[model samples]
Target: MFTGLSAFPLTPMNEQGVNEHEFIRLVECLAEAEVDSIGVLGSTGNYAYLSSEERARVAKLSVENAGNVPVVVGIGALRTRDVLANAENAQQAGAGGVLLAPVSYQKLTDDEVFSLYETVCRSLSVPLCVYDNPGTTHFHFSDELHGRIAQLPQVASIKIPPVQNDLAAAKARVAGLRALLPSDVTIGISGDPAAATGLLAGCDAWYSVIGGLYPEIALALTRAAQAGDTEQAIARSAALEPLWALYQEYGGSLRVAATIAELTGNVSQPCLPQPLRTLQGEARKRVEAVIDMLSLS
Candidate 1:
């Protein structure tokens, strides 16, 4: 199963489609940096925005170019059929695992959500992770729901979102999940700001966004936390506060990350959709300063 600091890369796109050549280069960079794994098409990868063909292409590109690193593809969709199709596509593309969130156009009942996963996973031979992202999906998974889903044959891991702005509460959430989930299942921390605390509190891995752009640092933090080295973990975690603060202020890490790639000359500026935009004017300068502060530039 995929674990540790799983870097979720931003899919570089051009007019025609996903920029295959440059995207592969980014994947190779993660491999060289020795990231524990690569998560393609995650929230940061804009899974909801891309076409099925684009997702399939990125999955193949990542798995092919990742060298020895495991590639986990995000396969969440509004419909069960679409999610199943995505799962099949990723599995066919040689993905290590697939991350699935219950994104929906309507509020889903607990039974509906549970059934959705049971149905989608029933057909897949590959292990799947339940992505309990309440913010995007708006479908909350209570502990009871989690227990029911744990019984599903293909459910191997649960990617739990950390409680925003409350690292201690986030730790408790992970602890609670550890208590409720099957012992064999791995618990990964996804919310960026709480990753260090969540890992220290006992989550097995970090499903990271910034780590996609800065794998070495993310790897350092994850390893330190895994090793129970509080000082190193705190140091690395503290270093990330500025950027994390921006994430909280701007309400997301997507735009901040996309802007960093542009400012650092990693790729041409990413084309984010409406209501979400890269940091601008003073906000842009502040982000650059934070990058310089962390020496990420």
Candidate 2:
């Protein structure tokens, strides 16, 4: 089972709206950090904005740079065929596994959700991780549903994001689900700020986006927690909190991605499409100051 941190690098867009070399360089840094794994074209990867070709190219480059580290491609589309195609391309590009979200369009039932996962598990030769992002999906999974998904032979893990309400309840649900699932099946948490807490709650992995900028700190925190040093983990997490604060300040994923790109020197010009506003004034200045303090770029 794969454990620890899995850094999801942001997919960059050049002036020509192309994913540039700078983006690939960022993934290489994560490889240098020796993170447990890499998730390509994930929500943080801006999977929704890129063209199919662009998505495949990013996945290929991510895997190549990742070397021995496992690369998990995010395959979430409105249609089943599209999701399958993406998965096929990731496999062809040498991805270690595929992380799937429920098809983003239309209201889907629990049966449809399981069926989508079952089909993907049956179609792909690689491992599968279910992304239970209820914030986006608007449909939460029950412990019984989670256990059922974990029982599938090809399904290896589940990615649960930290919800705003009743975190203790959510953590308890994961603990109970973990007990019900096979010993090999891992339960991962996706929120970067609550990573150490999630691991303490029995999550096997922390799927992170901010780690792209401070992979060493992120990895250190996870190691500290796994080694039973809560003080060490808490101290490292305290130092790492500013980066997460920047993400929250932006109030959007694009700015979060831009902050990461700027911190890593991945690209000097990071732009967001329609709907996602740009950072400016006090907000941009504050983010820049934090970036400088970390000396990440």
RMSD after CA superposition, every candidate: 1.8, 2.3
Per-residue lDDT over 1-297 for candidate 2, one digit per residue giving the tens place of the 0 to 100 score: 358888887777754665557777878888888899988777777787777787788788888888678899998888888888899999999999999989566788889888888888888898888998876777778878888888886899899876332447656867778887889989888877777777766788888877765688788888987887867876776776777787676663457657556644666655444454357678767777777787766
Off by over 4 Å in 1: 163-171, 273-276
Task: Give the range of the ten consecutive residues with the poorest summed lDDT in model 2.
Answer: 269-278
Could you give candidate 1's per-residue lDDT for residues 109-198 as a string of tens digits? 999999988998788877888898988888889988998898888888888877544556767777777787788788888878878888
Candidate 1 global TM-score: 0.94
- Candidate 2: where is the Cα deviation over 4 Å? 163-171, 252-254, 271-278
Clashes of each: 0, 0
Using lDDT as the measure, the top candidate is 1
The local distance difference test score of each candidate is 0.85, 0.77
Query: TM-score winner among the candidates?
Result: 1
